[model samples]
Target: MKEIIAIIVFCLALIKGEINSEILIVSENNCHQVFDKDQGQITSLGYPTFSSSNSSCTYVIKAKKGQVISLQWKDFNLPAGHDRLCHGSSDSVVVYDGRQIGINNLYTPMCGNHSFDITSSGNMMTVVLSSTSDEFDIMSFYRGFKAAYKSMSHHCKNMIYKTGYGAIASPHFPMAYPANLDCVYTIKLNQDRVMLLEFAEFALKPVKGNNNKMAMDDCDDYVEVYEGAISQRNRYFRHCGYYKPHPITTGGNIVHIKLHSAKSQLALYTGFRAFYYSGVPNKCGLFYGTPSGALTIPVIPQTSGINVECQFTIKSPQVAYYRVRWLSFGQDLFKKGCDENNYIEIYNGFYDKKDKLLAKKCDTKLDEFDTQYNEMLVRFKIEKFNPSRNFKFIYIGVTNNTVKVITDKNQTCTAKTTIVYRYSGPEVISREVKCELFSIGGLPFWASLLIVCGAGGGGLGAISVAFCLIRRRIRARRRYRRFERSDSEGSL
Candidate 1:
């Protein structure tokens, strides 16, 4: 009699297409494997044409640090709930944000046929699919799902870059930035390398004061630069305005930049575009035998801080004179006077209050001067905020025998040649041109050279000369347009 009852129950299960040989446990080996180095895929236990039975499967995805996991579903088909009692029918998928499964970290419980994506905030994610035997129906035999998971780096906020020479911008830059946005970027470079930051474009909502005049002292939306890793104590500068600030350089291997926007401002915000790279650090103080060296504010445009001072004292051999040449000089100019704000001052001797002041300059004009004494002191001071203000100069120890001055052709106009002469050796010539100048209308410089060379049958030297001329002409036209824009803006 018992055997007859068992056979009848087995027949009913067969008719319902329910496989009830204990729950189907898809172990880690049975489930799809997701390696940390590669993306992976997951599907229903019997996928494509899965059976309706009591079964459970779990898929785990992992990634290395500084990476996050993202899951995208291509197809999802399961029983749908008609009411609260059958929210996801008996078949459902539960996603957890991390490795450990807990009710608090449940991302979502999904069912039915739909496509969606979910990204984990950390390096791990867990997905579990379960079906109950009580709800098994022959019609649900086609229920199945498909998903893919991959590793990706964080964007928009709290980013870290290990390599060099990349861009960092306000989130959704070149568009109206989001309101109440806060982001931080930490740049790490090789040992002994420093950071160089240049702004290609910048625009932020200006704060207005009395009479609707633009206020410079206060800012509601601002970007802060730090010398080392980001910290409250390491704050370098805070900037906010329509005026584009100058390029900046860090003194160490790490640079942290923070961007913030206020809640009130929502539109007409064309954020900012900035590039960063690793470069050599600045040198200061006395030198023994290094023949020729350059010194400048480690950071350009001097936008990092206020009430800042940088001084360098150069001492040559007793018989040699310290010669200084300004490669490029720029500073904040006050209509009233030069000394009211940022300026560079040269002292005849080791920097002293009693020493003679050779010159007090605060403009872009180029200048060359030498110190009367064997020791020379150069000082740069910034008493207030100034955008895009900086100075670069080169110095060498010269005696009566090594007094020859080699003129730089690029000094008068933007040329591509640099001539250097050593006191003990022959002259060294170096030609350098901006890489952008070589490309004309998206064509490589070599291609243009080849076309011109092939058409004219000119020598290699002539081909080189022709290429330079063409590049120079194109650069001149670009400079003309830029000058015109500058003039128009000045008039406004």
Candidate 2:
């Protein structure tokens, strides 16, 4: 009972402090990022946004008692000339005036592309961005991430730009290159205080054939959205030396793309870029291919279950170790069985120097059905998970079935996987099942009389016992009176 009371008190305290751990991106005139509490509730101070050209942004994420609290800049922009004091004062009350956290001094120099990391105590987030190149100086901070940026070189100068998905390039630069380039950029969140997720390198390749076209929007020209720019129509088109496209948001993540050429497979290569951030690193820039030559790969991030990326036919039963840069909690890789209906799970120990491996028991059979209803999807929820920990599931042999669960580790697992089974069948019919127990029959007033008579008889028995006691007492009294009268007569 006392523990329950403590938990309640703790939660109340957390809610009051405005501490939150969510990474929320809201679309507004001023592009805003809100870190919400666990229940999706916004704090009183509200979410934060870019205030001005020189304004800096400060984010406070913490859990007090038991509730998540978040406080950000609702007022004021980053104070110019005083870039060193961007995080605000120690006792600063959260508000929108010139007092809240502002954008760092890098807005004008670096074009507002700033990144940093800090511990819960605020002692670790002490990095100053004074110049344009300093923003990219974070390469050392993100040691585990792939550290390359893709751009169209001068070699490609005269090719028609085709808007598609994934990476699609031409022999030369896009004749409509300004309209076709789209790229995806991913930022990995490192919550582990000790070990940080490192990015080695990433490669950008051109999508083959018509696959790239499908990734573009319905419009003939492709438009990109980025940080300051939220929408396609409102985007500021910049094509100075290299065409810098905007980023897109889908399924609650940010993506950037560029369609530089119509036919040349120009790829951006970034070596190992590693760093530690607040959340897990699951986001990546995806270049889509056209529908005619679509990659048809699973687009969801793996949070749990089995994610299998393998070839169907293999002669030798060879065992080769697959190493993902890192796997925090709620993420795993799996192999597909006969088709997408079956899978095998795998995980490598993140902490063990020896790298101990464990595999979860297999699911013998999975029901295959496809529909547009809620119950048709499989949901997996993991709460209070650390990304550094790894768990594994075994696959007896390889088949053609596989599935992946993609969700944030810190948030409740609640990651749902919906399987689409393609088959020709009759339309499903709905029917109701009903059960009737027993019915009552009408009784006459005689039944009521019987109940009343039984109650009356019980009352009479009680009254009879009382009357007998009274009579006995009266008889005794009369005997005593007679004895007294006789005694008086004798005396006379």
Candidate 3:
């Protein structure tokens, strides 16, 4: 009879839509849950209008990695205190910014009726409601809060890379980066190889308040590069504009790239795409022991940057002179001279600017240049707002007493050969001789002609003509020998 009476009382409590005070734990059916989907909704336990003392309910929201959760509250009606402040209220709803439940993770606490929205910086969020010993009127019911949550995947932050070659883009990349967005990427390579960073495309926010200019020092959006690690002192270059940036080589194996966007800029720009790879050391230094070599700008399809400079010094043996021959050359040239814009300058000594100026060339022309001293310096400089340019040249060490002979053996009756003689001493003299009429096995030309005519059966008439030609050739050869003997005696 007692058990039947208890069952009837429990049925009566359910009919009244009341929660048992002893049932303090929240079950899976009573709590709201969400996962990787787009949206979800949650309400208080026994929602739509009910009050419970000593009851607990929880709501869990989740999203994908690298995404955040956004929540919007529709209705909030907790029992208010007499002072109208929810700082120390007994009946309240607490929001945890992350999945952990702790005092430090609490985002906010609400007690009275209010509607607001908030966003979590992580992939998960938790909302908890607890009504301890009912402090308000027991006869009246209080409606709790209801909220809707959605996943947002637009936030950009930290990224890491560990490979030989990789690419990085802005927050939205092909699209415009979000306003007030700061993104950073760290790239690491093997210890023996250096890092090379090249920009395939770059279109940042242009400078404002200047009609004639397309770039400036003050930029609304910019990208910065660092050499070893990310720090203020290790910054290598900072750039902005629509022009593509030239390739940058770091000193060590690590590189850090940082991108910053201002809040005011709203125009859509395709930001930038940068590529990085491992490379050998490419910088200004002294080169020796290399007999013949070629030097040029390492990166292709390069663009404009601020006050960039590259220098190289070529040193030869003590007794030899340096000769530089250009295979290909092209750059932005000024009408008057190469003092402005992008240019390459050559000096005659070990130091670049401190030495004597040999010549400066920026136009599209192939030329040869020789240095007076044994060492030579070549420097290339680029200013703001310039097109891409490059040059290729070969350098060789030449001695004064060197003789080079070149011969072609493909001709049937005659062979052409060139001989170049370089004289030593203070006053240098060089000359080239071209010899084309020389017979094989020291045979006279007229004799060879006679043999060929005899073999072809041209009769004695050819023999008579060959005999006369042979006598004349013998006389000519004697005269040439006498002249050579006289010349040799005069030189001695």
lDDT of each: 0.60, 0.25, 0.61
Task: Pick the TM-score winner.
Answer: 1
lDDT of 3 by residue, 231-308 (tens): 654554456766554355454567778888898777688788676645544332123334334555443123334455
Question: After best superposition, candidate 1 residue 382: deviation in angstroms?
Answer: 25
Ordered from best to worst TM-score, the candidate numbers read: 1, 3, 2
Worst 10 residues of 1 by lDDT: 419-428
Which of the two, 2 or 3, has more lDDT?
3
Ranking by lDDT: 3, 1, 2
Residue-by-residue lDDT tens digits, candidate 1, 1-492: 665664565556545765433324344466544456558787776454444456667778888765667677877877766652347477777777667786535544677663346655457778887777544443334437888878877666767755444555576554677888788877777754665565656777667742123443477787776656465434545666664544454445677778788887658877775666455553332232233345554443333555556676656442245566565544343333466446678888675675488877756666676776557767777554343454555554443233333333331234454333222222336655433434435577787656656665556668679879999999999999999998989962
Report the error of model 2 at residue 279, Å: 1.9
Q: What are the models' TM-scores?
A: 0.31, 0.19, 0.30
**lDDT for 243 (candidate 1):** 47
Best by lDDT: 3
If both were scored by TM-score, which would come out higher, candidate 2 or candidate 3? Answer: 3
Per-residue alpha-carbon lDDT of model 2 for 1-492, expressed as tens digits?
665664564455447753232322222322232332332222212222111222233432323321212222223222233233234321111222111234421111111122221221111111121211212221121111111111222222222111111122222212223223443332222221111111111122322333222222332333232221244322222111111121122211222222232244323321111121221223121221100000112223443234333322111111111111111122321222223433322223232222332322233232221111111111122222223212221111111111222232222123333222111111123333333322223344555444544575586566668879999999999999999998989962
Per-residue error for 317 in candidate 1, Å, reads: 31
